[model samples]
Target: MSVIDDAIVWLNDPLNWTNPDGIISRTGEHLWISAAAVALGCAVAWPLGVWMGHVGRGGAAVVTVTNLSRAVPTVALLTIFPLTAIGFGPKAIILALSLFAIPPLLANAYLGVREVDPEVRDAGRGMGLSAWQLLRKVELPLAVPYLANGFRIAAVQVVATATLAAFVNGGGLGMIISRGFGLGLASGGGQVLAGGMLVALLCLTIEGVLALIEKALLPKSLRRVKHRPPASVADALPAGS
Candidate 1:
């Protein structure tokens, strides 16, 4: 049978879905780690990004740090994590994945705030709005799109990469993948394929759900601006043309 056929067979086998080491159980563990990483990334990056963007001092430093984090390899971080106090568990996996998630969230939030119109900001200040008020009332709403985008990017990345959890004895779909590999290429190929497909499907589902939430939560005016149709050919043409 073809690889796809084999994977389907492996997936359809009822026995694979119920045991302690089953798909349902592993997926739950994977999502937990991924969510935890995203939560930590948001906590660490979002405030700094917003503050720097608002203050407009030290933004360069923040960008530099974000870039540095991106340069660090995921595997290297996971490998080194074992030597530190955070050794070989879900905590270690979460730490590594959180590092993976930070750069995009920070950069997007800062850029979003920076991109807000100066005139709007000036008007807020002229109206006697305090710095905090200006941020909350003016900038935060404008920055919501970028903030949501950062979440989308970070969450998807975390979900995909959380496969690393299995390597350190952290449970996730990756454990199934590891087990498949242990069984050898010919015998285990179907299991590996199934595990990978599950991760990919989960990431896609997460992206779709987040996209829907973003659309629903966006300010109505902003939503209109985003979804407004382009001018028709007749409308764009010269008068009577």
Candidate 2:
């Protein structure tokens, strides 16, 4: 039978979906792990990023870490963490995934606050607003869209990365893929494909939720505005010059 046909058969088999270790349980595990990783990442990154941007300091430090984190491969970290005392299971995976999540969250929050109009900052100051009040009322509200976008990036990344959990004997749809790998091309390739599809679907679902949240909380103008492209060299030159 075709791999696609095999997958359909596998999917249709009620026995394959028994509660404790089935797709349903695996997806639940995936969601919680991804959620924990993202929550921890945002908690660490968002406040520091916002505070630094508001103060107009730490941009260099923040970007340096963001770049460094991006450069570090996820596989390397996943492998290394298990060797430490954290030693396998969800904690190790969660820690690795959370680090993977931090760069976007931190960078976006920082940029969002920094990008707020100087005139707005001045207006807030003019209103006898304290530093805390300015950040709370003016900067944060304006920065919300960027923050949400950062959240979207972080959450999607964590969900996708959590599939690697099965490598460390944690849990997720990767189990089915790993089993398929053992069964070879003829019999179980469909299992691998199905596993991958589940992960992709999870990622899409996360992105959809984030999109809805962004739409509900932010106006269209503010969505993803932090990532404007640079002007071309011609556009950079003064018109008269």
Q: Which lDDT value does model 2 have at 77?
A: 89
C-alpha local distance difference test of each model: 0.80, 0.82
Instruction: Give per-residue lDDT, candidate 2, residue 57.
Output: 92
lDDT winner:
2
Going through the candidates in the order shown, the clash numbers are 0, 0
What ranges in model 2 sit over 4 Å off? 219-241
Q: Give the alpha carbon lDDT tens digit for every residue of 83-163 in model 1.
A: 799866777888889988887788767866886899999999999999999999999888877787778878988898888
C-alpha displacement of 109 in model 2, angstroms?
A: 0.3
Best by TM-score: 2
lDDT (10s digit) by residue, model 2, range 1-241:
8888888888887767775888888888889988999999999999999998899898777756765776798878888998899987778888999998887888778878998999999999999999999999999998987788788888888888888877766787777788788899688888778877877888898889887877887876767664532211122345553
TM-score of each: 0.88, 0.89
